[model samples]
Target chain A: MVSHKPVIFVVEPFGGSIRWHNPSLPLIYWDDYAVTRGDGIFESILIRDGHAANLERHAQRFCTSAAALGLPEPILNSWINATQAAIEEFGEGEGKCTWTYSRGRASTGIPTAWVSIQPISDVVLAQREEGVRVMLSERGWSFPSELPAKTLNYAATMATLRLARERGFDDVIFTDPDDGHVLEGATSTVVTVKGDKLRTPYDDTILPGTTQAALFAHAESQGYRCKQKVIDVDYLLAADSVWLVSSTRVAARVRRLGEDKLKAPDNENEIRSLIDAAMTRG
Target chain B: MVSHKPVIFVVEPFGGSIRWHNPSLPLIYWDDYAVTRGDGIFESILIRDGHAANLERHAQRFCTSAAALGLPEPILNSWINATQAAIEEFGEGEGKCTWTYSRGRASTGIPTAWVSIQPISDVVLAQREEGVRVMLSERGWSFPSELPAKTLNYAATMATLRLARERGFDDVIFTDPDDGHVLEGATSTVVTVKGDKLRTPYDDTILPGTTQAALFAHAESQGYRCKQKVIDVDYLLAADSVWLVSSTRVAARVRRLGEDKLKAPDNENEIRSLIDAAMTRG
Candidate 1:
């Protein structure tokens, strides 16, 4: 009955073999701390033409996230091999491949690792092609010495997105509560473009964006000056254009921030090409 | 091979019958949002003498947490029933019973719910009996209007505990980053005792602790003045005695808060008995 369901590959005991199972089958112990305490780290990468974009970078960030949680260091080669296995099965076209590394059952002390592929939805594609209207929500805190890890504890992120959707927006831009410094999007990194230079928020408070980094690296090589600093909301508001970038959505221009309308990216085609080039580069 | 493993009961769906499965048999989908995004709500209650303590209160808080995440309203009766089933199987003695409800697979829109029972570890019992030495860790944020929800997104909570443990402390009391107000413990609620008054931080910024609430009620009924206020670190430091209260732990006396020694609760026996009576009342 579940033959048609997509299968996820489990990486057995980091640096070990891989096994595939149908999604319908139970795959995680009930007491796995990932589900019990959100005690885990994860990474998602965009796949195009059977290629997993930024796999290396994503894997590095995966390790960084694990370090943040004090989890045992992940065997990067195992993750890469497993992600590739999933992507290979996904074949051509755009899909999102996510790596979930969970602190397994407390008694076991072993970690549960798996990779699953999901097709990018029409809504996401539309947002990528057009733009997204966003609302500003407060993250309610700041980390001056370390960025929040890209952990599986994303309840706030999910809630923020729900809040925006309820208000008739596609996503949200989180602003620091103490000061209205534009932090990042609910699931993506915030980027602003003004004239010749491209800018994004750089601080110990935001998750360092994998897609943003890739895009910036490509853009910088292409002679599009890029800068990262603590960004004020006003600066974003006054920017020539804005975009929310991530592994799957790639780069979705911000059509509206709150009630204020935002201009489309001045170099839309160039920006798309740069992102595509970066994604395809690997 | 897994016959001796503890079993977890899955609620077929809210308002449906339950089925038990061994934890080793894998009870959750790999993509369940509870693991994927930590998008879920859960509750843990102390099971004493075959009774699930203050279950009604736990269920209510469970609903509150679900509401915070904009999840479908839980059918509380099913949770209560499932919890009772697990506790009954545990039978005669103290244990920890946890209820987990995840916003199931996105495609299904059906929430996944389950209950599991665990024997409370001796370390926890010792903490409850001998008191805990705690350190103050900054929560790194302030929520003045709405207390953080007890959601599945507990990466920060787990990380905080890890940090405390690394420093050789049993637990941590989080202080408001903005003003150093005493907040709550990573997995427990903070309470202070001074003279005859029992006080705990009261605000939208802390989880409304179920055990703490029950303790306060029992204490109030006994003519011990109980106050809920926005307590400061100074107040807790000057407190004659302090406690970190939770479901399974009941009320653990704070032997030390940072470097300062705390006097053992003048009414230690009374406090323990009061907590026991409240748990037994249900």
Candidate 2:
């Protein structure tokens, strides 16, 4: 199922529009602005067969995050249309689509919306097959209100990721400094499978990932026990299997955590089955 | 000096260069792009007599902040030339000039630079004479490294300021959550006169205000003792005089804090004298 590499398409809703400026400059510039300033909120959705997977859930999350940040309501229909346009422009591809909105520019110091589109890199697809080795890092210093929203202030996460990458790790798992409880990954949500029971962190400190939520629902329907509870790093290391879920990478198994190599089932078919279930729902 | 309202001018480095497909729309509509995402850093300078006050310091701080966030450096000479061009385009005035840079329209995630100029608002100038009321709030959730860089993640400050304004205050004094020590103001540095000594918070949790540093130097030369220490909210309220210092406002007394009305001195001339001395050094 993961034979071919997925190519994700990124789109910026306010990018190509000429309502304000000449749409001559590619939306890539606007995307760069979003990335640099962390000034906006973004939602990433998996795309399969030219349709966004769990798009409504992603859109609702986007709106909720935007509202929390006091940003104006994004025109969801227009955004959907923009996403469709981007998909059509890029053609059918297996990957994710991201949409971002910022407060518009005004002297009042409010942000306006901006958007962009990009293709997923090959390395992201490679992680699905080879799995990932992650290290627990104490970073993600954020307020409660800010945790759930995908705001652009990802400097801390970026710093941690850079450190993790330099230390020969694919990703970093953030833990609460107060008690050493696992929070989430820098760009993805964490799910640990102990036998049939799956547990995730229950807090606003991490994004409520669309893919994770869908997987939870599917797991429940399949009579698999799922719980959202605060789990310490010890529990995570002790878990039988740990998976990181995001819009782009559905569920990548954690093979090695720190120095401890955990026993993961060689059930690639089961993992692919879970992803297929999500794709069907998509 | 406070008898008449001051005039302001707004300039953009990309003013003529900004290509707009829709001329009827406001320039702000174009801002909906990445610049608003706070993916950039900015510096605000007070321009007096056709010259930017503390131009070097402002430029250096701007560069430092940008570098901290991994943004590409703005060409200093080009920036100076562009700023001069902007000022020349806007002519001379007693208002403030703000230079904002976003990672420009480059494909790189790092910000290039975007510059905009605007006149200082009358309300900001009004506070110079009328003084400002402040309320204390918590800014404990942020990390120390993030505190040093003036990235666009100002949501916390903005929220505090909004609450302060709603409560009939000019701005907020952020306090440490652990011990309730006063950190700094939302837009300015907090300084208090206790006996003949001037004191402010000493920590990387606040932007090292250039104006505050200058004030310390001027105060020392004027035979006033200068100290940097952890100050509690209670101590701030009990100080002999408390002032909010920034480049544009120079110095403004805190007339009220929470429920307590301060007996602050209306020695605007003396404060201006010190500010003028510091500006001369710039």
lDDT of each: 0.80, 0.67
What digit string (tens of lDDT, one per residue) describes model 2 on residues B1-282? 423222222222333232212212332222232333444566767766677777888888988976775556666766676566555655566546665565443233433444434566778778887788888777756653643566656555555576678788888888878778788888799988876688988876677887888888878988889989988878887888888888888777888888889985655467657766786577
TM-score of chain B of each: 0.93, 0.83
CAPRI category for model 1: medium
- How would you encode candidate 1's per-residue C-alpha lDDT over A43-134 as one tens digit per residue? 98887877888877888888888887787888777777777788777666778888888888888889888888878877988998888999
lDDT of 2 at B186: 80
Against the true structure, what is every candidate's RMSD? Answer: 2.9, 5.5
Local accuracy of candidate 1 as per-residue lDDT tens digits, B97-214: 8988888877788889888888887799799889998989888644323325678866777787877888878999988776777888988988787877889997567778998888
Give the range of the ten consecutive residues with the poorest summed lDDT in model 1 chain A.
Answer: A140-149
